[model samples]
Target chain A: MEEISFASQLLQYTITGITIGSIYAMVAIGFNVIYNVTEAINFAQGEFVMLGGLVMVLFRVTLNIPVVISFPLTIMVVTVVGVLLDRLVIRPIRKPSVLSMIIATIGAAFFIKGAAMFIWGKDPFDLPPFTGRNPINFLGAVILPQSLWVVGFLVAVVITLTLFFDRTILGKALRACAVNPNASSLVGINVQYMILVSFAMSAAIGAVGGIVITPISLMEYDRGAMLAVKGFAACVLGGMGSFYGAVMGGLIIGLIESLGAGLISSGYKDAFALLVLLFVLFLKPSGLFGSAEISKIRKF
Target chain B: MKLPAAREALPSGRTCGECAHCSSSSGIRFETGRDLPVKKSKNSLHLIGFGLGLLLLPWLAGHVELLGHYMDVMVFVGIYSILTISLCLLMGYAGQISLGHASFFGIGAYVSGVMTTRYGVNPWLCIPIGMGVCAIVAFVVGAPSLKLRGHYLAMATLAFCIIVTIVFNENVELTGGPDGLAFIPGLSVMGHPLDSIAKYYYLVWGFVLVTLLLSLNIIRSRIGRAMRSIHGSELAASTMGVNVSKYKIVVFVYSAALASVGGSLYAHYLNFLSPASFDLFVSIKLLIMIILGGMHSLWGAVVGAVLITFLNYEWLHYFEEAEGMIYGLIILVIMIFLPGGLVSIPGKVRSLWAK
Candidate 1:
């Protein structure tokens, strides 16, 4: 192996970090949406991502469908699954406590993972890169084309989500519901519908993340739990309901993980991110961008 | 249960309503009440009977060849019983959920395993050392985490569990990595090594009995009252002079210590230590056990541990590939239909029948 310069190594780590961070950011955003409206952190969010990749593989590889068709189909299928989860599992509980809902989501996550294992047979599946597998060399570092796809999708999703939240009436309605459901219902907003929409949108976002990252990172049945944990760490680090916070938290976590892997023992890579999570939680639960009042939202 | 009612019915010179902490709606009035001698005697009789039964269980199992297979399962049930009971104290009494309890269990196992295997330390010394380490780690994790309400605290513990698991798998020098450490020495008392299954059965269940007694004493004490108050309402608990955070942390530490003790026994019994044995799934399994049996009831924890252990070892094994599916389905069905858990089913049925 050629000995690379320290600067080049740092640059390479940054690129890899951003790519993975983008995925985490997407997952975090998914968590933020449902949490904002329902105050339930859907543990199945990562499973949706896993489903996205695996379902896409099923459509494209097994069924010989085109990538373009399979991608959207995967997102749609996952979105429907998310909606059904809310309808069947979350909605039926008349007096849903936060603890109960959390456990319920965990059960859903396990169910989805088990179903995935049965369907996918526990092996990792790969997707062909959108363009090619060739690495583009920079001044001293190299980057994959798939990484560009990941970064690009993340940027697009963020912009779209920002626009959806700010400029659209439906987005405003969702935001209103999130802020105060009783007030929103009093003002004639359908809080239930908004919650359903949030779940669907969150699942769709997670699916996009899963689909794009599959080419770079292979998909497996049990991978959802780890992704969910990392995403949750990102969500907590970013401030639970803040969108921009989620993005920033994801990037910071990604950078920490990649840099730690590059500079220290790769074996302890995950520990670095977890340490940051613990520190942030212990010292400042509100996170960098979150308001102090956000920490006081503990209902039960 | 009836003793509290009997105490409430006893008319003393003082009015029970005079006590500020007494809630009239709960039907249990607290006064300077005298102990019911008859009730005490009856309880002691029941206790003696239960103790006798527990003592005779191993002897009966030894004589019956058909029951030999269950000796190992019963030993594990004792281990899980400790974990579930501790979880019950935290979740049922304090209204806190921990998704990473397996980390404490794993820490205890590793600490004892490493000490016994690497340093050749006595198993007796290792158990307490493991409990101490687990208690400190629990304190550090719980101090910050207990401040967060509900799901966030759960997530924090989950993150901590993930980090611990990673460390177990990555730090090959300390933990034997994914392959794990083996040849851990069995536990002994006064150098009499508990090598046989029946001996381990007695040893584990003996600890279980002690733990249950301790837990029962705590639950019936003032500290338990404060914990129950916190579960009802933290703000109310604080207003009533219950140091809410202090009790939460103390209970969390106690629970971790119990799990650690169980882990030490597990490591010695299995004569091996692996990261896989104490993964996130183990924590979830423990949670499910407590939830299924009845999170609030002490005996419920024991029942849950035994039933779930049987389900995992016997029932689920038959399904093989569908294990996760069945496990997930059971949790969902229970949470949906019987949120009060198996312990409450009898009461629920009685109420329904009355209606």
Candidate 2:
């Protein structure tokens, strides 16, 4: 056996960090989408990711469907779940406060997770890598083929979202609704429809993240809570509603986690991200990219 | 500018002082604008009746074999009552939401459990020490987090809780890691070890009564009003000369201390401590207890705790795999249909009858 050089170790950590960070960014984006329009944190956001992974496994593994078909099928299934959540859990509230809405979402999360447990069972299920399991050697560093797939999926999401938000009329209307629902309604934009769209899109995005990461990290029913928390940490670090901020926050947390696990103790890896979250929150409540003035005005 | 003037002039609405028909000494009015249903003497009578009922519970259970089997469960109810009552004060009154209260409860359990096991410290003496530790930790955690409004504090507290649980899990040598600490000595009065379930039940209920009495006193005091004012509106509370941040921190500390006391009691009574007991799920369970019982009153806390403890420990065992689903459904049904919680049920029934 050969001794690995320090530079390669650093590169290995970087590769690992980027892979995990991409997933966190995806969850954070989902959080931001609903939060922008509703001013309520959807606590069940990570369950979409979990559903994506499990549903994909059901299609690709159990049914032996092709990856191409399974991917879209998984996303669609999760999207329906998101739509149902909006219709059933979210929409029916007569006068929703931030607290009530948050609690409702939490209940929804528990229900979804429990339902998944009943459907998928307590044991963790795995998805084979999109590509082969061969380790790719790059600049003396070893990276899994699936890590590349994970990073690629995140890139593809960002590009698609960027185009959707910038070029599409529906996207612009969604933005208008986010800016001010009352004003958007007056301008004839359907605020309720936009809210529904946000839930669908966020759920779909979360599904993709779950699909891509499943090969690397096994899919389990109860993993959503941890992912949601870490994703929330990314949101706070990146500035809650900022897209670029979510990306940066996710990557930074990933890097810290990987580097901390490698350099320090692996047992304390999760704590590193949370510590950074607390530090960011204490020093800068608005996050690095959010405006303090804007945060002060927002209800939740 | 005209709109602002109109809003300011719009009717101050029924001040408590303006309620001329009330015969109470203090000018207290219900939020629903209804007359006070119970007089001061009646309120005292209700308290006495509640105390007497509790006092008779163990004796009544001794004769009934089925009830005797659940004497331990009753003890747990008393323990959880303290935790829920404290949380009700912090969340329902002070308007500070904490998702990490289980951490304070955990801290108390761990502090007491660890100190007694490692240093051979007296089990009874460790209760205050655990509370002191929780108070300091809560102060440091609450100061910055409480400064932020809404879910930010909730998030911060949750983060702190996860961190604490992680430390409990990772620190193998000290905490005994995931296997948890065992052979924890039970508390004793004088030379008598509280070996029997009946004795422990009485002891635990004694603490619950003290906690309930203390909480009621606080709720009827000036500090409680200050807390309620903060809940209504922090800006308004501050303008009215209530030290908003100071009271928030104080209540936060107080709540943490009470949770610690519960934890300490739990540790001594069980004579075993596990990190799993202090996890995020337990924290959420505590939140559910307070929410289900009704957040607004001390008795509501006790009722919520007792019902939830029974459901979690007793009835839910029948469901097994479906337990989590049922618990989730319970939260949804209560939050959606009866947001005021189980404590509001009688009032709801009366309103329906009126209709």
Candidate 3:
């Protein structure tokens, strides 16, 4: 085997890391939006991403629809599922404990996974790249055009979300709900409806992630769990509910995983990420950018 | 605000002397107000009835050809019962969830399998070693994770499980990787190896009964009351000098030890060890069992184990492709309509009838 230059290998891995990192960041963002408002981690967040990819596959590949039309449609469909999830599953519980709510979300995740299996079958589906299947050479490393699309979409989504949360009245309401739902309600904010909107927005973000990444990484029914776990790790690493923290965490995780696979054994690639997660959890329960409130147990 | 205020309304750190429902010194209260002697006798009767049912099970399986097919599944139920009961102790009593229990189970299996297969260690010795390793790992993991409240434990355990599974798959020389380790020696007592299904059945259930008895005793003890207190309110429990964090980690370690025992038995019974058997799905299935049986009751764990074992072995064979769908639907339906689980169904029905 010919020895590849260390610098070139580093560059290649960095590019690969960035591409996958964006996907993780997108998923983490989704988690942050919902968690910010509801304090509930939607375990089904990855299923929205899976639904995005699979729905796009249905529209574009099976039904012969154009990519331009199918992509937005996919996001819309998953957003509706997210709304229905909140309406049918989350809202109906009379007075739910944290454990009960967690179980409910887990159940929802399983339901979506099963539905995906029934709809798309067991086999993984692939989507054609938005552009020609040619690798673009850049500084001794090769990058796919599809990778650019993934990074581009991620950047656009994050910017849009940042703007939405910072400048919009609706986003302000959602932020208020996160800070103190009671106070938000006292101030005439519809906390419950805001929660529903957060779920919708989160789902839409997850869908965009799924659609773009599907061209590079194939979509399968069982892929939701792994994606969710990775995204969750990113969320935890960056600091749950911190937008900048999630992105940084995602990139770091991706880089560590990529470099670990390159330097160490590829077989233990997933373990490296998990090890980092455990280390982060043990040393800093609140995460790098998370609020101290998350670490402290509320006194009755 | 209403919910938080309602939770705070419950009286904290009250002793049995103050509460009329608790007549015993152990602080656990049975809802019934019957006299001590009568309740004790009734409990003895129930115990005897349960014992008789257990003794009758294997005999009936031996006699009835139809039940012979389920003999293997019965052994699995016995193994899962131990796992579920331990989880019941943690989740139901202590109010902590572990999504990575299968890692403890896997460790137990791998340790036992490796010891028996490669090192020529006694199966009995291997079981204890597995339990010890599980306890140590659980202690190390739980110490940090359990300090944080709520879903942190779940996330930590889930990550732990994934890491363990990856190790199992990667360590091909030791675990046989994805193909798994086969030719594991069956468990033996003295000079006799447990080769037959009936023999294994008795052995497995013997362990199950012991586990159940131990759990029942714990639940009836002061320690159990401490656990209940923790579940009710960790703050209150700590305020009452219950050592909430210590109890949480101890229960977690205890549960992992039980899962290790189950894993050892599972390896010996099948005479094979596989990473696939102890994956995330197995952990989820164990959770499902407890949830389906009713997380609040010990008996619920047993019922859940047996019910899910039956479903996996018999019912799901017809619709293999729809397995995930069925499991998902079951969880959703149960959480929606019957969150209290199958064990609570009788109570639910009686209340409905009264209304």
Highest TM-score model number: 2
lDDT tens string, model 1, B116-222?
A: 98999998899999999999999988999999887678778888888899989987988899999998999887878887988888888888888887987676566
DockQ of each: 0.52, 0.57, 0.59
Clashing pairs in 3: none
TM-score of chain A of 2: 0.97
Model 3, range A1-300, lDDT digits (tens) per residue?
Answer: 235577888899899888988988899899999988988888888898898899989998999899888888888999999999899888887767777777788888888988888888989999999997899998779999999999899889889988988999998899999888989999999988998999999999999999999989889988887778888889989988899988888888888888888888899988888888889888887788887786463221
User: How much lDDT does candidate 1 score?
Assistant: 0.84
Q: What are the TM-scores, per candidate, against the unseen true structure? A: 0.92, 0.95, 0.94
Worst 10 residues of 1 chain A by lDDT: A291-300
Q: Which ten residues in a row have the lowest lDDT in candidate 2 chain B?
A: B1-10
**Count of clashing pairs, candidate 2:** 0
Top candidate on lDDT is 2
The lDDT, on a scale of 0 to 1, for candidate 2 is 0.86
Top candidate, metric DockQ? 3
Full-model lDDT for every candidate: 0.84, 0.86, 0.84
